[model samples]
Every structure is written in C-alpha cells, then in structure tokens.
Target chain A: MSRRGLLIILSSPSGAGKSTLAGRLRQWDDTLQFSVSATTRAPRPGEVNGQDYYFSSVADFQDQVAAGDMLEHARVFENYYGSPKGPVKTAIESGRDVLFDIDWQGAQQIKNSDLQEHVLSIFILPPSIKELHRRLVSRGQDAPEVIEKRMQKSWDEISHWDGYDYVLVNDDLDTTEDRLKTIIAAERLRRPQQPHLVDHVRKLQSEFGDRP
Target chain B: MSRRGLLIILSSPSGAGKSTLAGRLRQWDDTLQFSVSATTRAPRPGEVNGQDYYFSSVADFQDQVAAGDMLEHARVFENYYGSPKGPVKTAIESGRDVLFDIDWQGAQQIKNSDLQEHVLSIFILPPSIKELHRRLVSRGQDAPEVIEKRMQKSWDEISHWDGYDYVLVNDDLDTTEDRLKTIIAAERLRRPQQPHLVDHVRKLQSEFGDRP
Candidate 1:
C-alpha cells in the first residue's frame, strides 16, 4: 500500500522566508501539491482562477462551508478564504503531500480538524527584529508608516511560534530549506503513515517456528 | 548557550543490524558519545575498566540504584547491567549526544524517567523474518540451537515496535542510516532543545515599536 501524505503547514511573520522555503521544497519534489485556497475576493490582474485561488461567489463560499467542504476557513476584511477539504483529501489519498502557506489561525483550525494526525506545522523565525525591519525597508514597496505597521503585526505573528510542531530560524535560506526537507522526509516514516508494515509483519510471523 | 544533547536510544532484535548502524553513526559524527554501561559481572581478561564496563560489586550496584544514579538497570541471571546517570548527564549538558544500545525494557525505563523530554527512541525492523534468519545463520559463530533461541526473541522485540518515536526498516543499511541522521538533525532544531532562542526573541521584543 502507498503511504498517506502529510498536510504540511508553514507559517511565519511577513519578512521571514516561509514562502521562499515552500517554493524551494516544491522545486525539490515536483510530486508535492500546493493547496489552492477558495476565496470570495476578486482575482488579481495576473492571477489564474483555479491555479492561484479557487475564486468563488460569497454565497457559494458560505454554501461550501455549511456543507463541510472546507477543512478550515476564515473571514479577512469582508472576504472569506478557506482550504477545501475535497482536493486535500484526494491529494493525500493518492499519496501526494499538500503544502499550506496559511497563517497561525488557519493552521490551528486544520490541526484541530479530523485530520490532526496528518498535519506537520512549522513556524519560521527571522534571525533578529533589526534584520526583519531591514528586509521590510529593502522591499521599498511600503511607506515608513506602513513598514512600522508591518513590524507591529510581525510580533503578533511571532508570538504564536510556540504552537508549531517544528521551528526554524531562517538565518541562511539554503540551510533552512535543507532542514525543512529533512523534517518532511523524517515525518513520512512515522509508523501510522505506513500501513503496509502490517502485511510485512504478518509475513514475518508466518516464517516463525512452531516451537513457541 | 549550548544546546542539550539528545539521549538517543536505538533498539532492535538480533540480526536487524542496529549495532552496525550505530557504529556507522558514530563514525559519521565523531562528537557523538557511546554510552558505556555498568555491570556487576566480573571483567574479562581483555576488558578495560570504565571503557568496556564500569565493573561494580553487587552491593555497589544496589547502592547506586537506591541513590537514583542509574538511569535504567536490569538483573539477568544474577548479573546486573545498567546505564549510569552521571556520564549521560555530563555528556548532554556539555552538548554531546549519547547513544544507548539497549533492549525495549531499558528504553521504556529511560523514557519514563525525569529526562523523558530529552529522549529520542528509534526501533529498527528487519525487512523480513527470512532475511533476519539468513543474517543470523551467515554469522557462522552461533550454533543452530542458539540461533533458534535468538529468532524466538526477535519476535518478542518486534512486538514492541510501536512504542518508538521513529521506526525504520533495515531494508538497505545506507538508506536507513541517512534517514536516521535526518531525524536527528530535525529534532535538534525543536524549540525546547534550543534555550538560546529565548535570548533571540527577547532582542526582537526590545526592538518592537510602542504602537501596541
């Protein structure tokens, strides 16, 4: 039997490198699937409907939520966004690991759901707040006031770091990516994930002597 | 601050190749310390004191046990053998991982002790009982009856495989060793194992704006 896939949840403060690490992991293992979240918001100019987000009507999103189609959902600035249970179930059942690039609240909801045992949550930390601020400034997209607002929100995100199963400090991008891959490889070998062991053990039992 | 070392307990039945893997791990990382057990049995002519075993009188062994200096101890056919707490404590505090080659019973005792949080237990399984038997027969030093007795005990060992934190099938020695190293590397990054992270977070807090 094929091993069941893990639901990998990666969360971090805005300047931390979770998105970069997630992208690297996908590049490393092409078979892994990235979760496409359903959202009520309008698609951006360059965004594809199903590939970027499962763009949906507000009524349709609510209906799916009520029908238990969402693994986890949240309202953000009058827009509903969620991870659909159907696609994740199909992916994992077919032995494809799904990656989630959601925040801590979404991670918590999925962890508390029925699929808690399959979740592997990781939190990435910026090496220092000075570095975090420097990175935000280097982006050059945000004004000074906006950068300060983001700095405030970063701590709010970092406060929930303890809730994760594994924590990584993204001081060096390559090293952090390597560590994340190692974590995924090890989690795949967990006993409950490998049901084929039952048959292997049964074969061993048949080979035992009758003297016992 | 130095990270505390993990107490790695590797358990496997006879012919499962745990010993060979353990030796390879030590060779792969020379910093890892092998746990030398204490015993009440008389030392052999070639045995070096403290290097081979901390040879002790039965009364001395009992005294150490009563004093809570033994991490896990057992009596087998009137001889006492145990993991001493002192060496392991010193090694871990100084940032040296210790390897324990013990049975399931010893593993259980160490896992239940005060140092439970520091322990990482792995159980190795042979790919098949036929393969395990073949490995034993190929050794050529053991008589047929002795090999049969070991085969009986192998089943008993395999029964407790679920109790380990990680399980690996010894299908390929190199692959199993690589997986073991990966598990250890990821485990070292766990938040509780890295106390210096507290200082890192505190620095972040100091740099935060008073906007909250």
Candidate 2:
C-alpha cells in the first residue's frame, strides 16, 4: 500500500539562495519532480520554454484557470502565473514527490488546496539585508532599478516567513542544504507517509495469532 | 527569545530495540535530558535508584500522583509507573529537550498536555513476531510464563502504533538509530522550536528599513 507523495514547497525572498538549494535537493534525490509553472511572462535569455516555465498567452492562462486545470494561480503585477494541476496530480498519484519553488502567495494557495495534508512548506531567510542586496547585485542579471524593485519584493516575501513548517536562515549554504535533506529524509519516515506499515503490522498480527 | 524545549516521546513494544536506540540518541546529543520515571515496583539488580528508575513505595507514588507532581502515570500489572513533572518542567524552561522512554498510554497523556505542541512522539516496531519472541527469549530475564505474558503486552502496545508522529520498523539497529536521530534533528528545525528566529528576522527587518 504505497502512499501519495509530498508537495515539498520551498519559498524564499530573492537572493536568499533558495533556487540553488532547490537545485541541490534535486541532485540529492533525482526522484523529486520539479513543478514547472505556466506563466504569461516572457522568458529571459537561457530560460528554456517548457523546462523553465510553460510560456503561455494571457488568454490561454485564463482559460486553464477557468477550466480548473490550474491548482493555484495568481496575478503578480502584469503577469499571470500558476501551477498546472495536471502534472502535479499525475506525479503525486504515481507516488513521486513534487518540488515547488514558489513565493509565499503560491505556497499559501497550495497549502489551502484540497491536497494540503500532503504539503511540507519551508521558508528560507537570508542572513541579512545587506547580504541579500549584495547577492542580488552580484547576480549581474538585473539593472539597479530592477534590483531595487526586487529588494522591496524580497521584504514582502520575508514578512510571511511565519507561515511555514520549517524556516531556515541561509547563513551557510552547506549547512542549510544538509538540513533540507534531513528534513526531507525524516518526513519520509512519518506514519502517514508510509502506508506499507499497515501491512507490516497486519503481518505481525497474523504471526502473533499463529504462535500456538 | 529562546523557545521552550521539545518533549521527545519514544514508545515501542518490549524487545523492539527502543532502549538501545534511545541510548544511542542520548549519546548522539548529550543535551537531551532523559525523563526518568518513578515506579512502585522494586528495583532489579544493577538498576540505579535515580538514573534508571526512581523506585518509590506505593504510598509515595500515589501521593506524588495526587499532588500533581506526576505528569503522566498508569498501573502496569501490580506496579504504578509515572513521569515526574518537576525536572521535565525545569529542563524545558531552560531550553533543553527532554526524552521520554514510555509506553503508549504515557505518550497519549503527554500529547494532551499543555506542552502538546512541543511533543515529538515516535514508535518503533519489531521486524517480525518471531524475531520479537527470539529477542525476548534471548534476554533470559524471566520464566517462560513471564515471557508469554510480556509477549501479550507487546501485542497490546504495538496495536497503538498508529498514533505516533513517526513509526519505524527496527529491522537493523544502526539504521533505526540513524532514523531516530534524523527525526529529532529535523524536528529541531521546526518553526516553533526556534523562537530566536524571530529576533533574527527582526534584525533583518531593521536592516531592510535602514537601507536608503
């Protein structure tokens, strides 16, 4: 009796090293399936269309949301982004854990969904605002104005850090990554996650009864 | 803002290797305080008065139970066993995790305690009934009738395994010990366990506000 998979949601402000940590987690366990969100926003350079995100038209995104094909969707300023329900449903039903690297809003939406019981949400915090700003600037990916806007968005995300199962401060990448692995490994041993324990106990019961 | 410590409750049927695993956990983290139980039963040879069990007379045990000194207690066969509340309260208040090697009834009582949010309960299951019997018989601690009686009690204890937060089948001692350590380590990273994280984020918030 195999159980349904967990939805491992990782949320962090920009420059908090969450994306890098998520990548490390996937490398640690290749069984983890990354959830690629569908977005109306244009992909940046080097961003693969289907791999990075399911690039979509606003009309197509709205249609999917209306058709109940989106598990959770939100309008982030000018663009619509959402987790498509189809792939996630298929992954979890087949007993493969789905990893979600989303913001606080997406995490909240997924936590409020019908499959909320299977959700394991974690929030990552950067060491300091100065460090966060430094990392964002060091990325060399955005202009000063864009980085400023992201800094404000980072604060908004960090404000909701209280609403998570586990919260880790990214003071050290190696330590934080190890803790993430430990959390995932331990979560797998929980009673609700291992349905085969039922059969094991039943076998023990029969063996107990058979001892004459 | 240091948080109050967790109450780690470990339960298992006899001969399930819970004791050895618990010993290993204490060795794994010396900060873990073992909540020694006071019992009305007389001490066996080599069992320390305070370290192993706080052997008390029936009247003394009942008095403690009535005086609200006992956190949780129950009569097993002819003897009363209970966890004293004084040391556990002090330990947790000072920010030290306390470990309880107890049965399911005691685990249930602690879960209903006011400190329920801090409770991390785990149950260990033996690999097989035949293996459980072999372990019991190999111990050579009792007569055949006593062994038979304990076998029945083991079954009763295993029946309540569904209530624990995590359940592990003790097929291999080292693996089970490692899993127990992982569970404890991961639980420490939970949001409620680290109240100091509040201070951390507040500092970050100030840092954010100070940025021109």
Model 2, A33-65: lDDT tens digits are 999999999989999987999999999999998
Two-chain DockQ for model 1: 0.57
Q: Could you tell me which residue pairs clash in candidate 2? A: none
Query: Candidate 1 at residue B55, lDDT?
Result: 98
Lowest summed lDDT over 10 consecutive residues: which window, candidate 2 chain A?
A: A1-10
Clashes of 2: 0
Query: Clash number for model 1?
Result: 0
> Clashes in model 1: which pairs?
none
Model 1 spans > 4 angstroms off = A42-47, A56-69, A209-212, B140-143, B209-212
- List the candidate 2 regions with Cα displacement exceeding 4 Å: A1-4, A40-50, A55-69, A140-145, B1-4, B40-50, B54-69, B76-79, B141-145
Give residue A160's error in model 1 in angstroms.
1.8
Judged by TM-score, which candidate is best? 1
Query: Per-residue lDDT for A1-212 in model 1, tens only?
Result: 56888999999998897778888999999989999999999998999988999999999999999998998999999999999999998888778899999988999999998888889899999998878888888988778889988887889999888888888889999999988988898888777677677777777777775334
Error of 1 at B107 (Å): 1.7
Residue-wise C-alpha lDDT for candidate 2, range B32-132, written one tens digit per residue: 99999999998998999989999999999999988988889999899999999888988888889999988999999999877788899999999999999
